[model samples]
Target: MLVTERTLAREIAPAVERSLPGVEVLAVEMLSPSRFCVYVDHPEGVDHALCARVTQLLDDYRASYTIDVSSPGVERPLRKPAHFRAAVGQEVQIRTATPLAGKKRFRGAVVAADERHLRLAAGDEAVDIPYEAIVRGNLIDEGQVQP
Candidate 1:
């Protein structure tokens, strides 16, 4: 089956949270067809033990993909509306599936976000990018978006 990255993330997020209380599945990335990375966090912060536990809980995925349970480091992926909302005032870099205003990439402080789109202040321009158009969007800073 051809599962989109977001589809995989949706499937894994709740599964992890339900199985391990307090654990939030931040983002699930399909690095390649057979490689996937799961970003997770907790109120107390993430540790090697936590990653191992998440890995264990996701044992079923090993049969299909190489799963890497990880901590959201300095640069974090923005996969949902909440992620963009929480990153308001934070700098981010994003790539769209197709060019917007003749540009496929953008970098700026997140000025606004709603379920449909995120607005950014890039230099002298205010760019609004639709979430559906985003191929990849990431906060490029010392990532600290309320866990």
Candidate 2:
């Protein structure tokens, strides 16, 4: 997601949490400049269809600002460390904001990942990549989004 949108979500998440108790937001992302995707790891038996409508209602009820919500696309990027861990032994493409070894990109098998950093097995060597350096990372699907 864009910085502005992330800021907005962080500002609104507390309110969302209060209104929708026990609804844990799993992830949020921007699909495009105007589209925002929100994923909630909600409690079972909650009416998702109603929840979606309620979300729309909330956006409409609030006249000052608005947010659009939707599901993750067919392919989703790894947004957390657990996502990285789940991709162990899988090929992945990662991009960083700052250059690492003169570049901001790398692709290799995910060796390990935790809250702190990601370790990628690139050829015979393993490289430790700090989380702050990661711009985005996703499992490499030959026919899917690389990063």
Candidate 3:
């Protein structure tokens, strides 16, 4: 089976969270065949020490891939229901795997989110996007910085 960022994120997130309380793994991305980025967030905020610790926790991947542990920065990724739940009332950009209503991308403030879906106030209409359909989703900072 081909290893993907999403699969790796799901597999690695739980382990990371178990080891580091309050640290959430937001997303994982394959930068190249031998390199990858692990976006992590902590309630106390991420610092060099936290990043280094996460890097150490994931040392096993170093044999095959160069892991870059990072703070989510201004634009944090949204993957699981908890991520979206915390994003309520915040602007976001969501791209769906399948087009909904002639559109694949939606940008708006998240109004509500549940286990299976989230409601987005895009333009004049509110859109309901299923969690499984989200190909990519991230916070839209709009010139504002966040922890």
Better of 2 and 3 by TM-score: 3
TM-score of each: 0.89, 0.63, 0.86
Pairs in steric clash, model 3: none
List clashing residue pairs in candidate 2.
Answer: none
- The residue-by-residue lDDT of candidate 1 on 1-147, one tens digit each, is 224787888788999999999999888888888998899989999999999999998898899899898999879788789999999999999998889989999888999999999999988999899988887888886545342
Model 3: lDDT of residue 140 = 92
| Total residue pair clashes for candidate 1 | 0
On a 0 to 100 scale, what is the lDDT of residue 57 in model 2? 41
Which one is best on TM-score? 1
Error of 2 at 26 (Å): 4.4
lDDT of each: 0.88, 0.66, 0.88
Could you tell which candidate, 2 or 3, scores higher by lDDT?
3
Q: Which parts of model 2 have CA positions greater than 4 angstroms off?
A: 12-26, 31-34, 39-54, 57-70, 142-147
How many angstroms is residue 23 displaced in model 1 relative to the true structure, after the best TM-score fit?
Answer: 1.3
lDDT tens digits by residue: candidate 2, 61-106: 3464344544333344665687788778888888887887777898
